[model samples]
Target: MKKILFSLFLLGCSASFAHAHMFWVNVFESDAHQPPHAMVSMGWGHTLPMDDILTDPNSARIGVEKLELYDPALKKTDLIKIKSKITEAEVTNEHFDIFPADLAAQKIALKKDSLPGVYQIGAISKATCYTHYIDNKGRYRIKHKSKDELDNIKEIKGSLKNQSFAKAYITLGKWTNPKPLGHKLEIIPLTDLSNVHVGDMVGVKVLFYGEPQSTSLKNNIYITAGSNTFGLDEGFNLQSFLVEGKAQFRVQSKGQWIINTMKGEDVTKDGKLKDLYGKVDTVYHTASLTFNVK
Candidate 1:
């Protein structure tokens, strides 16, 4: 049993490593005579500015819990309820035990004439996965699908302890909100980005469970803009852990930006837990938000 379990996990690892998948909303100007709308796409890519990654058949089937279009101009928020298409097939990935893994939003209409102001839109998942896996020196990072390769596969039993949040920003015609959404782990803005420009500093706060994340160790927080990953600029990815629940940073570029927060939690209290592979389960959580600069 032990050998079979290990072999299955080994096969899983070789086939996939947890890839970086992010939720994002793409905005485009309505062709001359159409109502403005947006496409909520869950993209798979190496990092931020997911401009070049695959879309369409986009990704996932998780039901969207909250998809709100916050209009600062009118201080009115519209809730867009999305229907998730759950396939009859089961996907036994690191994230989904035996359920299908493909929930996402198609296109949706926005508030009419919602231009010339700063607008915030985001989607929270009502359906979350309790993923189980191992965490070993980043070697066993849960891959979307494990591959078949022989490398130093570091790992230990684990599960996901975080919820997924996808946020976005827009400037329809000059108004702003700049208020935090108070997510469990939120990377919300503290400054208005409706009319931001280059050389202008847009402030942001990182909150874990509604409070500040102590320390700004780059690792705990990853700020990325199109083509420019903050890790390369800062080097080492700020390996320190988020000591406090509060963290803050500023955007220094003009483009679509995605801020991702990752941290591990010790789930040892629940007592003796083991995965199918007979290893103790440890878990970590991740949260992300996106906005445009200028």
Candidate 2:
């Protein structure tokens, strides 16, 4: 009986060794359009409750949690956990902090060649590694920080691209993570323009980044119709707006402005926009673009 029990213990240890998978994580912005800026963080959503781990040992154990990815349909595609370690002597593209063996982990990549939809991407030693999370239903929520701005959409008629068409500049509002109370778990900034005329094209150009301030960072922007919104996405680096109609306007020169038609609203009124809903405040830097009609 003793010999049989010893053999079983050896077999279990072997299985554990064979199944030792590395744990890791990849940080991403809530919006897919925005690029990822990674930091070793913990907590739910965009709120990083802690700073990155410094001081490397011979080996490190890193655990990835609350990871998320977005699909083209603007949905929380997947979420998963990756826990692993890295030896202090691994070479790679960027000289990032390497977790000593058993401490280094990589972001999982989605494998669509066999299975579709977002899924957990496992890693193999000495092979290309990409880590992704599993798909969850209630992991994400819709976050809009500027509902008052979205209310300022006005009608306009002008010559955009040397052609006559109806136009308007509308704000669809910004979404924040860690959703605030009275906010849906998943919110899409898309606006309904089913009543618009056919052949009309809408353009959505977004600018997001931390602006240098005397004391803190802020999100700022300049727009058409002599409108400017500064410190709008305060403490956050993600911004998304939806405009379903085309607008015709050009920079007259410096501060001067001229619009071909006189039928639009200054969305940012009183130099301030209201925060809608988000549980966790974020800090970010990015610029992105999206153009669509719906």
Candidate 3:
């Protein structure tokens, strides 16, 4: 029995490590006739720009909990409500067929006749919990629940609650630097995103809970960046440790690019499990920022 439990623990670790998927938001200009509108879609998987479509079942596990748009003047709009009012005709795109038949994308209209500047779109995903354990039947099991909520479990291997935030910038007429949206885990661009070009160094700052993430030798945070052209080619990507919560990457190619980072903390160490959900052993916070380079 002890040997079986050890094997189950190893299996749990492997499963957790395999689930390194990232979520990001993609923005595209609408058709020529559909003025003042942009088509927004969610990207999920290990690739940039677009990857696996968010099917209904997987979407329920890690779907957008809230979506919002900020105009150039910093006027906030609840995109969820706007998406319901607008029809598919209002924001039709020639590339709409590229998405799956059951695509969960949205069409958002910009402020009518508003000044031309950078607009920000952000999405926050619902928190999801995964628990790995051995059941009373001596079978290893992974369930979307916390260890504390499981029944008839012989041994608990691990549990994690994950939440992700995705952000993208859309330039209408003129380009402007975007301000941080105050996500729990956020990536803020320090360089001008609109003027980015190949071979240019783009700098960004990572903040956790509105504070810069520490980069001490003992607690270094690393950020990874990839381009749509590479598509899951890790060797072609860039990874660097943050210094004072800031890092920079040189543009290797021109296309859609995504920068993302994740941080995990033990909930039990801080009594967060007892004080908060009481269902997770650890919690992970992930953030991604997507942009286009000329």
Candidate 4:
């Protein structure tokens, strides 16, 4: 099946490039003048015109097929089979799948009834992809007859890849500034408990700098602490921190202890970041901590 699809893809390419952006797969025999290989070219639109905007061009994903067998027939058989342990082969699709990669959000406590307004984390944008898919009892149900039909795929088709997704738990209670747009936050350590014990806890007071005075957002700061990385954000706060996304951990291994934090995505270059008010040219978010091991 893979070889068939691959061959079809390669043939499609040379026959006269399918719609420019459509993904193409290639197939070739080992000893053949042109060995089996596939090349992917991303595009902004079907025509691949000069003005088709291209962002992050080199981001590529490749899928390869490798099969191993035991007590081989040694006849260079076209197909290889195994006894009982069945390993499912991976199926590749034309679309690109980019996941959140699990970002860890920390919870920071603030004065009760702080921002006075409620906030909901909803998708401000959707993932515009190439194809749509359905699911069967056990496998993916592709809408088209085969990969060939995908060349003519149209836009505004099916649900946006990651749209209509699960919403973030309502971090109710407002944001004087909806967008947490800012550059360069500060970190101030209140206590020198860098050499604390394993079971110690500390109190850290974080002061957000460049906070717009137009809104009472003094209480919008949230902090997450871990053994090695610490994370701080505005708006939502919770106890459980996500593992896959990096965060800060105040570690106390035996007699050696240290207080540090890890940065989340989007670190701006050296320049002033504009805020909603447009009054403050640069914004700096800071954290102060004091803890004692229990």
lDDT of each prediction vs. the true structure? 0.47, 0.22, 0.71, 0.23
Model 2 TM-score is 0.18
Q: Judged by lDDT relative to the true structure, which candidate is superior, 1 or 3?
A: 3
TM-scores for the candidates? 0.55, 0.18, 0.79, 0.21
Ranking according to lDDT, highest score first: 3, 1, 4, 2
> 4 in model 4: Cα distance from truth in Å?
30
Give the Cα RMSD of candidate 1.
9.6
lDDT, candidate 3, 1-294, per-residue tens: 533533443332222211356678888765466456778877776676655654423222355677888888888887742121112233346664332223346887766576688889888887877777778998877766777778999988777778899898877776667888989999988888866888999899999988888655555456778876643445345776788888998888888888888777666646645554557766778898988887
Whichever of 1 and 2 has more lDDT, that candidate is 1
Put down candidate 4 lDDT per residue, 127-159, tens digits, no spaces. 221223333333322231222344333331221
Question: lDDT tens digits, residues 74-189, model 2?
Answer: 34433333343333545545656444332223333332232322221111111111111111332211112222222222321110000011111111222222111111111111
Put down candidate 1 lDDT per residue, 1-294, tens digits, no spaces: 433433443332222212344445544333344566556554324454442222223232234567676665436465545345444434456664443333333565656654555666666655333333344455324422222222345543333323456677655555565566656656676566555555655555667677766544343343333323444223222222344443344455656555566544444534432231222233334556665556
Provide the lowest-lDDT 10-residue window in model 1. Answer: 232-241
Indicate the residue-level lDDT of 46 in model 4.
Answer: 22
